[model samples]
Target: MSRKVDLVADLGEGFGPWRMGDDAQLLDILTSANIACGFHAGDPQIMDETVRACVERGVGIGAHPSFPDLQGFGRRDMGLTADEVRTDVLYQFGALHAIAAFHGVPVTHIAPHGRLGNLVAVREDYADVVASAARRLDPELIVLAQDGKLADAARAAGLRVGIVGIADRAYEDDGTLVPRSEPGAVIHDGEEIRRRTVRMVVDGVIESRNGTLIPVACDTVLVHGDTTGAVVLAQQIRVGLEEAGVEIAPLTDWLE
Candidate 1:
């Protein structure tokens, strides 16, 4: 059977006058959007606009919560206790939920952004707390994380799981996310990204940065919205994947 892939665009630009991503254009190319909440980068206006845009484009909406570090764009790692992580995650996620609700758009899933996302992928205690926050908010909200124990934990807790796979990064043998600072971490070549993603979907496998083939359960594929040429990349990916006979749907369809 041809594998189905959900393309998630990380929408919601920067706060105030400084815009970070081409959210409006990117939305058209993706199946779903991981909308940023206030903690990481987006502002009230940005969130509202993002939600509205998603609704207009018929995109599946999901909360993209992050650590409270807009200055660092939520990519910088700040060591925090597990409880602290949970609290921050829920706080940010809730903001987006309300914003989406206000626009009459039901949030379909929850995807952690930047540092917070990396933390939850491999940290057992931190993952537990973060997953707990999602479950507490709504058991039906799928938690988008690297497809593995994290997804399993969320499922075990009765929260729907969206196994989001990435082509640029890799998971170490210990399950910790490979830091982006490492060499060859980010896949800049568009062809490579497409090839990796195709392999992941068709074979349920991806080559780690360490050159090891690892099994990955991918329901959604994340394309970073902030990167330059991200919109073009998403378009290319969508066209290429569809041409290969892969169905592009939202998180809800895959989870259901």
Candidate 2:
């Protein structure tokens, strides 16, 4: 039997006049999209337009919430309390949900963005709050996260979980992603990205920055739209995965 996987990308990471990635191209390639919900990058207009594009493309819509750090692009760590985290997530999710509803689509999942996402992977408190917030808003909402505290918290909260593998980012020996400040943190070579993606799905293992193999469960693969040559890289990864006998499906269809 062929293994199934979901291809997702972060989209709608633009504000007003500035756009981050080639969203149209990425949407054409992605099965699911984690759209920025105003806190990190998107504005109301961008959110509405993005939701409409996703709906037109038959892509699954997911909330990409983050700290209220538009300046840092939500990539900077902020000291937020559990209550703050919960309410902030709730606010962002609600905005996206409303926008998606207006477009006749449902916001099916929640994936924390940037620094918040990294924190949820390791911080039990942050993970618990994010999961709890999702459950409270909609019990059926899926939580897309890496294999760690967020996944555990989502499962414990009775919400469905999707383990996401980042194709371009380098991982650490401990399974965490290497900081962008580190050299060789983000892989730019398209062939290398495609190879790493195939190995993660077929071999269930990924090579860390330190050249150590770490076990990983990949239900979905994320190709960041903002990365250089992202469109070409995504196309290559998809083709490679299919050639390797892996079935690429949408997160709603494949993620448990």
Candidate 3:
């Protein structure tokens, strides 16, 4: 059987007048996008344009909900209860849903952003609430997450979970991503990232910081668009995957 995976990036991450990355260029290389909702880094106009562009390109649209932390770009850990998390996520998800509906496109999935994304991997209560909110909103919605609390909670709630393998990030031997605050948490070398991506998608494994082989079952690979040379890195990854005989497709098209 041929190996198939989705290439996704965080989009619509600009608020008001500031833009973060070249979403226009990155969109050409992506099969899906996790667009930010208002709470983190998006505004009404950005969301609308992002969705319109995604619709035009036939890319899968997924909500990227974050904590109510715009100042921190959703990277700050606010001490909120699980209920707060649920409501915040609901607000963001609903906003995106309305916009997508206006464009005649249904949102195919949901992925938490930044700190919320990290917590969902280890914090079980937060993960459960996120999963429950997604279930309550749309049972058919696929939950994109790395293998952790969110994946487990989503699965238990009968939601389809698409494992996200990030090739540009470092992982521990235990199969969890290293915290971003730590040194060397993110890989910068272009050739290294390309190799890691192909290995994660085709070989089903990635090398850990400790030189251990951590097995990963990836349905989608995240390509960060905000960093330096990000578009170039994304282009290289796609070429590397195609060269390795991996079939790239949208997550909604293949994830079940």
Candidate 4:
């Protein structure tokens, strides 16, 4: 039997004059792209360009929605009601959908960003709202999330779910990601990342920060595009996965 996985990266995370990562290089290396919608780090022009690039490359396009925090890049948590969160997500999705529509590309998935994403992994209400928003927008849209509340809510809401594995972030024993403030939370060693990525895809397991072996359902591996040496890291992961005999495919192909 052959093992298959999707390689994904966050793209279009740039504002008016400032850009975050080498989106062009990362796009070429990824099988799927979680494009930033307006709230977190993208504008109309950036979204349009990103969609066109994805169309040209035949890459899977996904909506990356986040809290309404541009200064903090949506990494700061806010106290908002369920309705507020739902509408915020809907707004972001609508913007991305419009841009993708203009470029004649189909948005196939939805993935939360930063603090909103972290909250969805643990908070049932947050997860429900995000899942509900995606369901309302498009029932067929796949929800890319970790193995937690968001994934469960998405599945329960009759939406397809893809379990995501963050290759550059450390995990807790309960499968949650370690807080970024903590030391060693984000893995930076290329060799270590490559080895761990291969193991996660091949064995469906990853060692937590506390040295606990946790079983994970990894449908896709995410490489942060904003990190230093992100393009090189993505290349290393792709090559390592292929070398380990794992077929790299898009999330849409693997989603149920």
User: CA lDDT of each candidate?
Assistant: 0.81, 0.93, 0.94, 0.92
* lDDT score at residue 41, model 3, on the 0-100 scale: 95
User: TM-score for each prediction?
Assistant: 0.93, 0.98, 0.98, 0.98
Candidate 3 lDDT, tens digit per residue, 1-256? Answer: 6788999999999998999999999999999999999988999999999999999999999999998999999989998999999999999999999999999999999999999999999999999999999999999999999999999999999999999999789999999888889999989999999999999998899999999998998999998878788899999999999999988999777777
TM-score of 3: 0.98
lDDT by residue (tens digit), candidate 2, 1-256:
7999999999999999999999999899889999999998999999999999999999999999999999999999989998899999999999999998888889999999999999999999999999889999999999999999999999999999999999999999999999988899999989989999999999999999889999989989999989988899999999999999999888778565
Q: Return whichever of 1 and 3 wins on TM-score.
A: 3
Q: What lDDT does model 1 reach?
A: 0.81
Pairs of residues clashing in candidate 1:
none
In model 3, the runs with Cα more than 4 Å from the true position are: none
The local lDDT score (0 to 100) that residue 80 gets in candidate 3 is 90
Model 3: how far residue 233 lies from native, Å = 0.8
Residue 219 accuracy (lDDT) in model 1: 87
Candidate 2 colliding pairs, count: 0
Off by over 4 Å in 1: 170-176
